[model samples]
Target chain A: MKITPKDVAHVALLSRLEIPEDQVEKVTGQLNAILEYAEMLNKVNTDGVEPTAHVIPLSNVMREDEVEVSLARELALANAPEQDNGYFKVPKIVEG
Target chain B: MDYSVVIGLEVHAELKTKSKIFCGCSTQFGSDQNTNVCPVCLGLPGVLPVVNKRVVEFAIRAGLALNCEILPFSKFDRKNYYYPDLPKNYQTSQYDLPICVNGYLDIEVNGETKRIGITRIHMEEDAGKLVHSGNITNSNYALVDYNRTGVPLIEIVSEPDIRSAEEAKAYLEALKSILEYIDVSDCKMQEGSLRCDANVSLRENEQAPFGTRTELKNLNSFRAVQKGLEYEIVRQAEVLDEGGKIIQETRSWDETKGITLSLRNKEQAHDYRYFPEPDLVPLQVSAEWVEEIRQSLPELPNARKQRLMEAYGLSSYDAGVITASQAMANYFDVVVGHGADAKAAANWLMGEVSKVLNASNISITEFAVTPENLASMLELMQKGTISSKIAKTVFEEMVASGKDPATIVKEKGLQQISNEGEIVAIVEAVLAANPQSVADFKAGKDRALGFLVGQIMKQTKGRANPELVNKLLKERIN
Candidate 1:
């Protein structure tokens, strides 16, 4: 399917990207070309093969219910843009 | 035109585990802010998540309790989203292949059983909470507490088979009880251990298919679930009656306002873009393990109710009430363990214990009186050390002061006055003072006999031995 500029913008918004209006067209073309190239692979016939989720053939990776020491409070908030009373602060979360 | 309400509930219950699902952070609630955070739960770069073994076991037990078919293999997927409370931009959840599928629960409505089909039960991680800085309408931002991040949650999705709000409420109740029976989740709605989101729609008749549906959120309690669904059903019916097209949207239940407000339209729906998580490997549950978990399953609510009825000779209603909560059921068994009669144990649990717990607004788990104390208090009544009336006083003292029944009876001087001479003197005094009731008793009025008996008991402050008072009064009157 051919991708549209509006679809690209919607995806960008969902991804929290602030793309400028002038770059929308250029980015849309690049994305659509990538999509077109990927769509070509869909033509190959592989109906009998099972879809794979991971590259390695591993399964059931689990751990026992043991707790380890956590990061120090200072280090945890080192990269955060803002912090208050040992918490992550963010803009209003409007969505339900 | 008459419309039938069709509802499907999505219940999210936080599993009871010592640590978070994907991290080693403590899963305890109401902790200091951010104290439970670790690199894995905080979504720091280059950190990998390992599945908690208990989470998987709890999910399987839940599936078995709900009578679901556990898939031999299941995988976790990343549900991409943008929310402040989610430390990670994407949540690890089950996508196309959930852990359990095609389960059904039977709920009772008007003494008739209605089966609600469960589409799937999947495992996922919960997000943290955001305490808004100001009024919601004008808040600049919010503070995020990551304590709940990575907490294991199982989302049980139900089919849209519910015909009314009452049925929806019943389905939720049954689901909560089953989870509580297995001791997987605390199922405390206030603490957000058990939460529900409902999808509701209306149709003109059974012949007509389900109309456009709207999803509702922010239902924190069972009352909210029922009331929210009720409001949505009526709101949809009114729109249909007015010839307005029903729009697919997500609505927020304004509990204070008692109306649902449109949160987002269909166009604004997020494309969650779910795909299998590459970091975590797929889960392959073997038949042996599933069988082992099944064998270890505790007796569920319905079975326990049936057993109570058979073992205690209690009516179905009484058994059902006593076993509604797991803690209460365990308490009932403990009370019986003290050698109290099973029927009496059930009665105390259903009547006096239930009433006190409700009035105190505390759960049976937090009750001050132990089963031994309660059983001993019942035994006090049995041994005639205290009349049932005075036993109530001792019961209150035991509950309030956490004292022993016998000690409370002794300290308060509330023992039954069974000594024949003392009761005879009290009865004679009552008969002399109430000459009217004495004459009425002589005239063969049984009601007056009861009145005179009541007067004697009142004179003894409800501590009089009732049988002795009756005998002494009868002999004197003759």
Candidate 2:
């Protein structure tokens, strides 16, 4: 129900974000304020209402399983910061 | 310090769809890297993912086959995680409301039918492939292939009902065959179409509360599944005996080392913050649609197994082996349809046919010998046209040349020598040459009769009608 500096740090770690140590308090306060502001919706006592995931009032928006033309390899990797032999290369992930 | 091993398998099968789950990209394997990439699959900005209709149908078909309850109202959710294989930080999967729930599959282990409860069957998109520079432990960098990203996958989660490695294997085999029978997934583990993970733990006894479990990964084969779990059980038992707690973690099966190594501990485990996927709307399955899908379902493995037992009068074991593969079962049916004796056909299929298939590492569909040809060969042996021994030689030639049984018999001069005159002369010559054996037979050495029969068969190149040879040899000796 409340955001703490430790919680903020954990969230940052999970999101792969590095927050400056001096700004942890500031970020924590900002997250709490956002949660408090959104918490106003809890004041409404409509307990019988069903939870809503989307507001579009639609279901089963789908497409047929058919192959369409795909992007060329050159175009697909055009924006890659680093690539090798038709692949997107990244830093070593040994933690898996 | 007795403990019970508890195992639950989570199997992921890539659905056989023409395109990726959300995008119109080909799902063909072994394509040039990145050729199947699209904006949606690559997680490019400003792109929306639409559900693939066939994926939902396949999920329902699997659910029905596994005896799961198909929820009319189901939706997808985003499971937040970070990995290089995932283009998006989170995987789009079903968390709370999976499409199918509370199913059960019956697996036979050691001649006893045990029902493994299915926890849920959810539809999800697969991650991309990561080709490491070396092994995961020492890889400097990894290359990513987005071709498999956004491919449709159904994750079937099982309860901790499996008590042994053999039971776990039976469960996996049953699951794979069902998926293959539904024509939903190809279920080829070598190609990564079918993958399995296990949650294993050891409790003091069956009545004890569940203990913390470790999740096993990288079990790429059925043998690995069984062997890995066996090793894990021993490892856990050792830990408990030493008063060391079993640390709940993810372990990678080091197949080369024949042991499981810890990849990460519980402290590093991902806290997947799953929330509803808003981009894709909820799926509303109608009763009519579910029924239609159910009606369209092919005869599953269990049903086919039962029918094989009843119709062909096969034993439970034989029926189980034959119906394990749909293609193999269909081949059996065609062989029977061609007027092959059911029991004889079952023996040949389970014996010689399966022997050749396993030795050549080919499937029944890829086998060169046709069911009609196999039936003809069986007929040759059954009708006394060729002895069973000669039939085997004929079968070997048919397999080598893909020729008809009759032609192989004719070309190789392998036909049974049923002619009485021909066999009588050969029997007489065998008697004359082996006069000691003849004397032994007349002096009541029954074993000598077998030796004389062997010589006669040898002289006739194993083409002598064994029954006729026995009768004629007995008449002449007496």
Candidate 3:
């Protein structure tokens, strides 16, 4: 398929991205070109083959149920845009 | 149109792991905020997440308990959603290929067994808790506590097979019991270890297609789950009957108000663009490992209830009550192990023990009376060493002072007045002191004889053997 301007806007909204008003058409064209480039795989045929989920062949990368030290309160809250009483403050979410 | 209620539940239970799912942070609840956060769980840049082995093991165990088929190869997918409680922009969960699938759990309703189909059981991480600054509706901002972040959770999704709210509650009770038996998760609703979101709808009889479903949330207890489902079923039915359509959305159960309020409309929908997590490797659980986990499983609640009923000749309802909790079942078994009669043990556990537990708001595990002490107390009553009335008094003393039953009986002089000579003397004193009752008994007045017996018992401070008192009084009167 072909990409539409509305589809690009919806995708942008879902991703929380803001495309400039005039750049919508150009950006949609660029993204559709990339999609077309990626869609070339549709031409390949591999019947009776399993879909691959991981690129690496390794499996079961896990750690034991052990406790490691957590970051101190100060460092854990270091990058918070807003902090109050050792908590990360966010915009009002009344319906939590 | 006549409608039948259809319900499906998605439950999330936190695993009882010592550490968080992806980091070394503690998974302890109610801890100081932000204390259990690490660079990995905090979603800091340049950090990677390692899956927890115990989490997968627990998911498999829960699957086996639910009689699900385990998938040898499974992987995680990122559920993309932006929320304040979730520090990461996405949640790592199993989407298409969950670890366990096609499971079924049997629930008993009105002495009939109803099987609920399990669609899948997948592993995920718990989101952090959001604490509103003021009243939730009036609050201007919310604070995030990362203490619960990254806690391992297993989401068990059930097929829409439940027909009523009672069945839904039974399913949850059975599920919670199995989780407790397998020792997978804490499964406490109050502490937020176990949470449920229900999908409910109403269709006209079984011939029609399933109706549009609404997801119900914030059901904090089993009662809430049942009551909320009940209310939603009626609400949906009323809406459909009024020639209106049931709008699909998420509704929060106002537990105090006893009604479900719509929180979000379906017009603004969520499309979680799921993709395989590239950081974590695919998990391959061997068949041998699954078999090992199955072997390690304890006797589940249903089978244990069956055995308890068969072996002890207990009623089905009695067995259900006794086996309600693992601790209570263990206590009963221990009491039987100490040579106490099974039926007698069941009676006391269901009656007196439950009374104390409910009154004190404590579990059987924290009860001061030991199984051995209770068994010995029962033995004392059985052997006529103490009257049943006196034994209750001694039981209170045991709970208060933590003393042995025999010691309390001996110290309080609460033993049964079973000696023939001693009771005979009291009987004679009662008879002589009340000639009027003697004359009345000779005149065929049974009330007079009962009064004399009562006087004898009161004279002995209620320690007199009731049977002996009756026999002795009848012998004298006749």
Candidate 4:
């Protein structure tokens, strides 16, 4: 599970991080250290152990099967970076 | 070289908890962009997450629904990542231990039942949305909306048991219907509330180790999931057949081109650098708590479908359609509860209501038709107060104006002509007018009987009772 310098570079590209070429080495070292610490988990005899996806086991969480109030136009657009009237404004999504 | 496509799905459904999984932020969809958010959800400096009790409860409910074994003790882990959508540098998700494991969903494909094994159902927070700026291809900047962030999500990962695109779609549809029936999520792909990512690979036969699988990410619709997986399967098969090594990578579906293009190489599972989330405490679910959730759990889709078949004598297709959405199923029950015929109500819902909703691209909730209104309309039909044809007309007016069924019937004067003397006179006149049809009916041209009935109905202005008219017409013709 040791992450090489190449691993950091790959992860950076996948995540779209603007990492400078020179800083790749430094970031790789830091990442490798984190990976090394994480490797300690393999020390447990988890051969038959199950992987956990959720902490609690329950099923069939449902509402009352009714439609409640929808967010108002103002509330829906309140935090938009840009808006026109009460609608969220975005650049034209289609080309003519 | 021919090959078989092997597909698996990882569906991420937002749980129906009132709050976020790891924070107290409301799990409500369509909330103000950040009004439901809190410091913990924002991942502010020095703030810690307190696991929502309902998150665990919901996860267990999902597990139980899938018939998965519930872990006695499960814990959260930090999945390290950096993205604008992810407020926390690391996402709090289950890693080494999940709430539910080793479940299976039985889906029918082409009338054959196939059981897809569910590997796990893990809980996590949903990321925020990224709205692109000027251009989608090359946007200057993207606006981040955190309303979706911190919303509880359960990722249901299935084993690679599916062998075709149709099977994949069927499995997803069955899963979606079940989730909707259980009231977990709206499971609306358009809303990004229920999303699917598919993993596809092709194999020659069972003897080989698995091929390098490509992950198709963020397919918002079932059609897209099916098409994306199909395209990938073909693309990978062609590549491997040409002696090209199939690269393990994540790809994006270019919906316009109907093709999948490379997004990024597959990240190793270990690349996540997962560790137990320190801020949230390990969840200890009591047996009593699990039992309580189980007791509170509604009848799942499969069980309800069976009950509908047994109790109401509904056809399997009708039962399946009615129970597809919890809302629609509950609506069906309401109408039936009001003394409407099961088969009759199912016919209207599956035929009329569903048809209208599908054509309008609206949900059942968007229409003004209530269950009581539908039941009363059907009752009018049963009581011989309105002909079936007239009932439909009255029902439309009811939908448009939300008027009472009786009022619509009264206003429209759509009552059936069930008076025996009146019906017999109309039938006699029709028979006398259609001598050729009466002669043909005597000659055993059964279709001529239909013509006679049509004439009588037309004379009565489409409100003639079909059963009564037929009885009178038969007697008069004889």
Candidate 5:
């Protein structure tokens, strides 16, 4: 499918990314070119092969339910832009 | 015009595991903020998540208990969303290949059993909790605690088979009981260990296609589930009656206002682009393991209810009330095992024990009276050491002091007065004091006999054996 400016804007919105209006066409074309380059796989006829979920042949990678040490509260919030009372504080997300 | 209300429920129960699903962080509730955060749970850079083995086993146990087909292969998927609760910007959930499918749970409403089809039960990670500065609408900002992040949760989705609010409640209650029976979830709504959401719509008739439905959230309790659906049915019916088209949207149950307010349109929020999670490997369950879990499953509520009816000779209603919680049913068994008669134990549990529990707002586990104490108390009444009325007083004292029944009965001098001669003297004194009542008794006022019995009971502090008092009073006044 061809990438449209509207599709680019929607993806940017969902990803919380701000795209300049002038660069919309450039981004759209760049996305379409990438998709075109990756579209060559569609021409190969391998319909009988089962879809692969992962490249590795691993399954059941798990650990026992045991509690190890967790990071200290100060260290956990060290990288946060804003914090209050040992919590990560963010802007209000009002539901419509 | 009456419309047929269609409802379906999605229940999310946090698994009772020691650690978070993908990390070794403690999943203990009510801990200090962010103290349970690990790099994996906090979605830090270059960290991989490993599944908790116990979480898988719990999911399998839940699936078998609900009579679901355990899929041999299952995998986690990334449901991409931009919610603040999810630190990863996506929730790790099962999109298509859930662990369980095609299961059904039977719920009884009005003494008729209705089977609600379980569409699927999938494993997922829970989001962190958000503490708003104020209400959601007016909050300047919100605080986030990642303690609940990465906790294992299983989402059981039901088919659109529920028809009314009562049936919906029955369905949720049954699910909770089964979950509790298998020891998977605590099912505590107050702590948010258990939660439910509903999809509700109204159609013109049974055969009519389902109208556009509204998804409801914040149904934190079983009562909220029922009340929200009931309110939604009325609201939808009104909309349809006014010739206004039903809008597909997500609504929040405003418990304080007792009304549902629209949250957001469905179309605007429906874009969750799900893709298979690559970091976690697909799960391959073996038949032997599933069998082991099935065999280890405890007797579920329905089976326990039936056994209670047969083994204890209890009525269906009594069995139902007793088996509603695994703890209650186990408590009943312990009481009976301690030499209390089965039927009598059932009665006391349903009557006085339940009354105390309700008034104290505590569970049977938290009750002051132990099973041995309760059984011995019942034995005292059965042996005529205490009258039934006196038993209640003894029970009250036992609850207050947490002492044995025999000690309480002896300490308060509340033993039944069964001696015929002693009863006769009290009876004669009562008759002489109330000569008019005696004259009335001779004149055939049966009520006078009752009044005499009351006087005798009062004189003896309600410890008189009622049967002996009745026989002795009759012979004296004859």
Candidate 6:
């Protein structure tokens, strides 16, 4: 469970980060400290203990079947980096 | 190249409650962007979540419907993660002690009953939607809309019991139908109401150890879930065959490209840094409360299917179709409540009514044909006021214009020609004109009876009573 410097480098690559070399060492130390604490969980006797996924015992959340109004085109496109008409603008996704 | 596919489904359904699970924000979909949001939903500082009572009730109802055991007490936990769409850095989900556990949903595929194990059903708040601006090409920065944030969502996780793509699709459909029947959620995949993530892996038939599985994300439709699993199965199988290890990872299905690309390395169960939620109090559900919710639970899909078979004397297939949604089943009862024949109503609802609903891409609730109107339409048919053909025309007009059955029948002048003299004249004229059928009927060819009846009904412009016409034809033949 020891996250070494090389391990952090690989994890960062998998996570799609462009970390500078100096920062990689710093992040590796930070992640290792976190993992060391997380490893303490192995000490607890989880044998036959169910892993908890949610605190509330519930199921079948639903809504009524109806068509409500959608946001206006302007609102939908407000945060877009680029747009045309009502659609979000993007680079050519496909070649002609 | 013998292999078995192991598949599991994680379904996230937005519950049907009027308000968000943790806040007072409206759970309505398609509201103005961010209009349904509040400080709690936006994760503003100083706002704390107040668990919605209806959220717990709906969950208990769902657990009962799925035959899950409700825990006496449960608590929420923080699943810490950094994501732009999640206004809160961490999602408040159940880390352990989910609301319900140990349930099974029996699904039928190709006439075989496959019992899929339900691991857990837990409540959580949904993340906001990320609106990626610009075209598919060079896109501008994306905007995050928190309208859907904090909506009540129940994530139903099933044990990996599925073995094929078709079975995965069947499981989703059956689950959606059950949810729809209980009126817990709309379960519309197109509206981002119900979404699915399929976990897929391939192994040899007798392999002791399972192969690495890939999680395919954001499959919004039944077809997509099936197709995504199928593609991943093929992809993993090919990888393993080449003596390459199948990587554990999260993958995205490029539906247009028909390939799954790795999105990120798979996070182990410990990666989320789960801890008990500090803001909300631990939920204490009493047995009496659980029993009350269980008793209040509506008749689910299977139970309703069984009753329809017994009470209405319908075939199993007919019952299954009619009981797919509570709304449709209740609509049928209303028609039957008004004294229309159950079998006739079932046939009409399954046939012409369902056809129109599908063609227009809407549910029965959206159609203008109310239960009373449908009942009266059937009444017209029973009383011989309109022939089946005329009844269909009137039913369409009733649905289109929201007109009453009698009004449509009156305006269309579709009364059945039950006059005995008028029917006898038409029968006599048809018997005289069709000498071949008359000769065939005399020779006792059983099908010739149908030909003679057709001739009379055609001559009468389909207005004659089919039963009376048949009786007259049989008597004349004798």
Q: What is the TM-score of chain A alone in each candidate?
A: 0.87, 0.93, 0.88, 0.70, 0.92, 0.74
For candidate 2 chain A, the 10 contiguous residues with the lowest summed lDDT are A46-55
| Per-residue lDDT value at B178 in model 6 | 87
Tens digit of per-residue lDDT, candidate 3, span B1-478: 6688899999999999999888889987778989999989888889989998989999999999999999999999999887789888898899998999999999989999889999999999889889986777788888999888889999999999999999999999999999998999889999889999999999988878999999999988999999999999989989999999999999999998899998886545568889998888899999999999999999888898999999989999889878878889999999999999899899999988888889999999999999999999999999999988888888888888889999988888888989989999999998999999899888988899889988998999999999998888888778
What does candidate 5's lDDT look like per residue over B1-478, in tens digits?
A: 8999899999999999999999999999999999999889999989999999999999999999998999999999999988788899999999889999999999888888889999999999999999998788889889999999999999999999999999999999999999999999999999999999999998989999999999999999888998888899999989889999899999999888999999887886778889999889999999999999999999999999999999878988889999998889999999999999999999999899999999999999999999999999999989999998888889999899999999988888998999988998999899989999999999989998899999999999998999999988888899
Instruction: Write the residue-wise lDDT of candidate 6 on B1-478 in tens digits.
Output: 7578888889998898887877777777786566676667767679867788888888888888888999877878889766667767788899687999999898878767889999999999999876765642345455566778888889999999998999999899889998887778889899989999988888888455677888899687887887888888888888888889988888888888877888776764227767987677766678898898777777888888889889989987888888877888989989999999999999999999999999999888888888999999899999989889878778889878999999876776778889888888888888888889878877878888888887776766677888888887778767
Report chain B TM per candidate: 0.92, 0.97, 0.95, 0.89, 0.97, 0.88
Candidate DockQ scores, in order: 0.65, 0.77, 0.72, 0.09, 0.78, 0.11
Question: Model 2 in CAPRI terms: which quality?
Answer: medium
TM-scores of the candidates in the order shown: 0.92, 0.97, 0.95, 0.80, 0.96, 0.80
Candidate 2 local lDDT, B445-471, one digit each (tens) = 899999999988888899999999999
TM-score of 2: 0.97
Model 3 per-residue lDDT at A15: 83
Q: Distance (Å) between predicted and true CA of B260, model 3?
A: 1.0
Give the Cα error of residue B197 in candidate 5, in Å.
Answer: 0.6
lDDT of 3 at B438: 95
The alpha-carbon deviation from the true structure for residue B253 of candidate 5, after best TM-score superposition, in angstroms, is 0.8
Q: What does fnat come to for each candidate?
A: 0.78, 0.86, 0.90, 0.01, 0.84, 0.03
Off by over 4 Å in 2: B442-447
Candidate 3 colliding pairs: none
lDDT string for model 1 (B128-245, tens) is: 9889877665787899888899999999999989888899888999899999899899999999999999988888788788889999998999899989888888888889889998
| Candidate with the greatest TM-score versus the true structure | 2
**Preferred candidate (TM-score higher): 4 or 5:** 5
